[model samples]
Target chain A: MQQNNIAIKVNGLSKNFDISESGKGFSGKLKALFHRKRKIITAVDGIDFEIKRGEFVGYVGENGAGKSTTIKMLTGILVPTSGSAEVNGIIPFKERKKNAAKIGVVFGQRTQLWWDLPVRESFDLLRVIFRVSQSDFNSQMKKLDQVLDLNSLMSMPVRKLSLGQRMRCDIAASLVHNPPVLFLDEPTIGLDVLAKESIRNFLAEINREEGTTIILTTHDMNDIEHLCKRLIILEDGKIVYDGETELLKQKFVHEKVLEVEFHDDGNVIQGIPGVTVIREQGCKKWLTFDNDNYGIGEVIGTIASRYKIKDISVNEPSVESIIRNIYNNRVTLAMPSEKSPTK
Target chain B: MESIKIYIMLFTTSIKARMEYKVSFLFYIFAILSFYAGQFGLLFILLNRFHEIKGWSMGEMVFLYSLQAFAFGFTNLIFSQLVNFDKMIVDGEFDRVLVRPLSPLGQVIFSKFEVSTAAHLIIGFTALYFGSRYANIEWTFYKIILFPVIIMGGVMIAGGIRLMVTAVAFWTLRNRSLVHTVIFSSKEFINYPINIYNVGMQFFLTFIFPIAFINFYPAHFFLDRSGSGLLHPSLEMGTPIVGIIVITVSIFSWKAGVNHYQSTGS
Candidate 1:
């Protein structure tokens, strides 16, 4: 949202994985030791983006689209093969400990907290690791307790908690250091509806109140819709789109759907300008029209004059559809340079 | 200082978790004791049948056996994770250790402490005491003090070797067979006196892997046996220093291995 105050900046970062051509097993391992055949797969191709302080950005991509790889590079868990990335003004891979100290990362598929220890003990251990002062630790814990409702779960062993409960505790554990940047990889994955809602709300509140810059990667479209204003779409190890979330939907979705109910059983609107009948069943008609070419009012007016319309409703394309369109390479959203205002 | 506190906390928590299965924990202790007892019984039977082997008295053999046992027990107790290194790497558990602020080696070494191995230590000490009495060696203060130093050196050498083997797993990804070869071969060398082997074999064992530094060389020096004339006077007097060198090299290798760690798929 702001320039030159970037909390995270990436410049042409990429990673390549060497997969043994012989495949995975004892034979492959032996083959890899000597006279090996290997294939180089690029997990993250060169791509760049910048996120300002206090921005919530959703990094969305399909499976094997390098979302996790990009996150790992950002978090300093994996080194980039080429190019560079900085979080909070420090190069991540070069100054990993410093970067780690300034950021919190949570992978929903895995828990970083000690399994046998109680949630509170795990939090305390994290505090010790991060070297948080006592008063700051307590205040942060209090904030986490209020936001995540962690009191009941704190005393329970982490291994004994349900997935949702563990996830809430994990978020709390990650935040104990009061890290300015937070990386959440599929934080709402495998969560129930209510659990997802609570996590989403807590994340929003923290980003707003604490000004915590967040980079969230999730396959779930709902998380993006609910939490992030900015979205970056990755496909085949490259960024296909990066812009405001609403702009993506507007740019990609060409047609809008209109549902009409006829007052008379036999009444029908055969055709309208820039509109195609999607389906008709039992006096209800679903029509699709190019939003860029025709306004909903003009379409509705034409439909009403042609047929006895009793009720009508219009639906814009959903975020899921827009993402799917990106994944299928059906639409191209404008890049930042292309969207810069003309002189 | 903070890392030490965290390590202690981790150690205590792991012990508590292990104790949660009280029956299994007790059974594990019993099993280890019985295994060591069985080996001791065989040693007793051998000593009863034969007066000595290679000009070495049964009591001296006991000293050698005890030294090896103590060294192996202490190494296994503190670094048992090394024995299971392949499983941790394959399961991606090493990723967890990497994320922690503390050294990954420290976390792994302290992750699990085998309390059951204490039984081996007790049995080894008992055998050493009885053997000393039977050997009827003069109770000089220097000889007495040298015993603990020898045992500590033995532990350090064993730990160093184990750490090196575990470190190899970083590159190899699987080292069970390699570990088995190294451990069993070293055990074969340590089970008997180093003097029994030819000079070249002695040099190989002493200079290369240094399994002899753990028990044979130290035991020979303590008993005033065959190795006294062969080794350099300073090296003979500084066997513990050799152990320390081995340990330092092993740690350096481990650090290098960690630097080369290419973490598995994200």
Candidate 2:
């Protein structure tokens, strides 16, 4: 029964937080000491998804869309109020230590390393904690050092390293035990372009070579487009979009922008059938056309007949715009009702 | 075995981290020494004036005081990380511990083991040595064996108390006042014989909170004044047993808190 392939399976998982309404000012705080208003905030509302082993899934959502709440549940840090979550076929919350042994987690906001010790020493401590054999630890370290370029950072105290260096070391540390599943939450949050690329490459390499299941959550659209083949978008604690990344681009309200340079007076060009002129420069006009309705050759022909010959370039919708479109129209999109929403 | 290895590794690594700031580490030692010296000075002044507190002599008082200090100092060295555990919960940093393949409580205890308690140990040992010499108490071989057992038991009791208080934060989220009064401020009450306080207060300290077992009750066995304290003369032997019971109850309390957190997470 293909049970072993399911790295993570979540069913009807929900978490509701009770936020006490405390009033402002001294008297309000004093009054709150006696009694405070309580409101229940549903963080994750009955989400269901099954991620197969070796799947690279991007868990994208707006702030407060329950990305972290869901991650905590899957990581066994938070018990979902209702429903169940199984990691590697074991209920995570019921068996945190066992689950932890099989999963590696990285939080970009925090470092799990010992702050004052050398980075290399922290890895050894982790080795001891996870009960990895000496040979396995060495082999893992060799692989990590090669991918992460951790040679220079290993000897330095963790606090002395730059954020980027520390992050790379963090990722490498998490993978030391060779966990079958890795969860990364904004692993490239504050890193520069090169650092982010390095991390992305490392992640991609690890997923490919080791067949590690990765569940990544990030605000960075590049992380999604470049690394993740599958994307799961959450809106207001509900699954708004979940499927192939390419399919997401194709299905969303994404339009192709054609930038045309005029050989003659481009200002004279006025109308085109079913095309919106989004931007107009002195000699260039940027027109957006629905890719589904119009082919690029057809659009170019329409513009070619109307205007003088010119150089033209067509632009596909960027991943950022596609994700933005999803978030903007998430509520209006046909919501996933009480049924399996795993596309 | 794995837990012990991990604990030692964590403890040593943290100590190594502390050594990185040599001047700061020395300052910690100096500060603790000065602070304990002042506490002992206060005790010295009070005992000099009163001479005897409810039939217990000055040397006897110092023995009790040192015992309390010893128990607290050792326990604090190990469990000082637990002092601000409420803050850890409030800041949502405890999630890091939860995700680890170890007991959250054990991780907290081992990873943050404090080195600043060395000065307290020095002060406690010095006071105990002098107190025993001055009091001229006959030391037996079995008495020597029971000495460490009594201290370890007392430490367990204090550690249990700390664990319970810190675990309370899982519900309240912010209860520094309770932690402060119950853990730190209450240490002053056990500096002298518990019998000096009113019988009601003595009973409360003995039965309800049990800070008396840490030193006052156990000290009676050494001071040859077992029957005079309160309740039962044989209660002096109850330190280790009471420790096991208290720690068991507190561990249960800690588990309950973790369950509550799992159900209603921060």
Deviation (Å) of B73 in candidate 2: 1.9
**Model 2 clashing residue pairs (backbone):** none
List candidate 2 segments past 4 Å from native. Answer: A263-270, A335-343, B90-92, B133-136, B140-142, B226-230, B260-266
Name the regions of candidate 1 deviating beyond 4 angstroms.
A1-5, A23-35, A94-96, A261-270, A278-285, A308-310, A333-343, B136-149, B197-203, B228-234, B262-266
Residue A207 in model 2: shift from native, Å? 1.1
Best by TM-score: 2
Q: By lDDT, who's the top model here? A: 2
- Candidate 1 residue-wise lDDT, B1-88, digit = tens: 8778888777877787677679988998888788878877856764576668777788887877888888888887888878887777
What TM-score would every model get versus the actual structure?
0.89, 0.92
Say what the interface RMSD of candidate 1 is.
2.5
> Which prediction has the highest DockQ against the true structure?
2
Report candidate 1's fraction of native contacts.
Answer: 0.17
